[model samples]
Target: MKRSNIRIIGVPEQQEEEQGLENLFEEIISENFPEVGKKKVTQAQRVPKKMNPQRPTPRHIILTMANVQDKERILKAARERWKVTYKGSPIRLSNDFSTETHLTRKQWMEIYKVMQSKGLNPRILYPARLSLKIEGEIRRFTDKKRLREFISTKPAMQERLKGLV
Candidate 1:
């Protein structure tokens, strides 16, 4: 499924000011995404991420963006900048997807990048499948194992994947 907004997750929980979640959200957006600024945000907040304390998953911040361009810019910056921080604490930005979609995207991360670098347009099908145009042919993979097997057989894919991985 397509997401209208991106999330700022893995931000260490912050003490709420008088404005609470809204203030925190604005602070992050203003600092990390100066181009978009606080005015463009439709909504923002911290949400619970259900994970074990043993693992210590940080609380997630959700941002309801004004448009896709703004969202994409923020996500791209987050990806390239790596571990953006606020008040000395590291934060992560991601698409605000359902848990299933998030897991699927994570699983296919490598292949997706490889496909893009190979000059193929790789599109993720909802619920976690990848479809791409490679060598003028459309190829789709619903499973990671099958995708890996396919990559192993193709020398070019194997070489590119090797350099990337």
Candidate 2:
């Protein structure tokens, strides 16, 4: 269900209604990926988080693509291109993960980077599972405790990842 949706950040706020947002979405696609013209958007709206008076950036827009393939195509393009902008200002496109899943992934980022730097080949699987390549084999961990246990088994990893797990 979340696969078809994307969250767009850094777009300036405007008083325009939903139709305006749809047009902006189109503009975003055209600006970043001209070949991927006019993909169907089932829904487009700003996220419902309460506005903070001190924050300068606008709330992110959550876009739902009618077809998951289109979403995938755009995401692939964004990854390859490395810069997706709208109206000359930088914007970002990413999967619309639930709060819990997003937080879980966020928690793994420090370890992910350390593993990556050490050439562990870490990957964050969908909905928040961490996978690592260890000695030509793949190992997947569903939670930090499991990962901690696995790391504890390896003396080298235990020393390197001390206090992180």
Candidate 3:
């Protein structure tokens, strides 16, 4: 018995000829329809002009250093009231000596600075008056005679004692 092998050739050349024929057919169709050869068919479009709307500018209110001072005092009073009511202890002059108390002071100073920068007066609205109710409640638990004596002895606590009175 003899073994024989057959080799194949010219298949790739035939595939290339088929590809060329397809390209020629496409070119003929495009030539017949020129519109098909164009990048796009654009309609007569009208571009509208852009119009900017008018906006109203904001007006600022001016504040003085006296107003900031008043706000600082009010905030200090509020913080003192918070300390007395929540700390489960008697209201004393030394209560304002802690970092917790000083946080409120720092926040108040920040608010004051923001108000000053914005040229807005720190107005004591109805909300601030509502905060005073808590202050009054704390005052009921305090010893008025002792507070008065302490305030007289130390000028630092005078304003806070006055609020209690």
Candidate 4:
């Protein structure tokens, strides 16, 4: 599958009429990521999702970047910073993956959270590697079988999984 150029989420929707999305993108990049050039942005749009009318929140901002290096830089910066806030709310920025990959990563979300709650900072790497930081060292599991093997080594993880696994 082809890698997506760019996607940014959790950026607050500014309710200014004169300041369009393009302008907002420029503003965000300038404010949070000065190293990234706004001119590299090829396409930017809001990803639609179901909203609550009584308490509507910001829709995700997705973009296509012309420069792959710039995109990687932004993503890396965002990850290092953890949460980028706008209007007192947190925002997320990430790479846009193909549907299959996205769904595949999503399926193991419960395990991800379980590992996190156990003081393991686990992350799913591109093309699907389950990486976790444990005891000041980073360990990665290449596939589900390897991940399962690693988890089986941890009785705590097994106890927590119960039926979830």
Q: Best candidate per lDDT, number?
A: 2
- Expressed as tens digits, the lDDT of each residue in 1-165 for candidate 4 is 455467667666663255866676677777776765564677778886677898676777777777677778878877877767655666677788877877878876777887777766789877767887755778887667877776688788677665555
Q: On residues 1-165, what C-alpha lDDT tens digit does candidate 3 reach at each position?
A: 111111111122233244442342233224333333422111111113244457322111111212333324433443545532212322211111234434534544443454345443333222111011222342211223543454487565454334543
Cα deviation of 15, candidate 2, in Å: 6.4
Off by over 4 Å in 1: 49-51, 103-140, 144-165
- Give lDDT for model 3: 0.30
Arrange candidates by TM-score, descending.
2, 4, 1, 3
lDDT of 3 at 34: 36
Q: Total clashing residue pairs per candidate? A: 0, 0, 0, 0
TM-scores for every predicted model: 0.56, 0.70, 0.16, 0.63
Q: Give the TM-score of candidate 2.
A: 0.70
lDDT of 1 by residue, 1-165 (tens): 556577776655645545576677678767776775554678776675577779877667677877777778778877777767776777777788778877877888887887787777788876678997778898889987787788888998787677443
Question: Which residue pairs come into collision in candidate 3?
Answer: none
- What are the Cα lDDT values of the candidates? 0.74, 0.87, 0.30, 0.72
Return the clash pairs for model 4, or none.
Answer: none
Off by over 4 Å in 3: 1-96, 123-165
lDDT of 2 by residue, 97-158 (tens): 87888899999899999988877789999889999888788999999999989998999988
Error of 4 at 69 (Å): 2.0
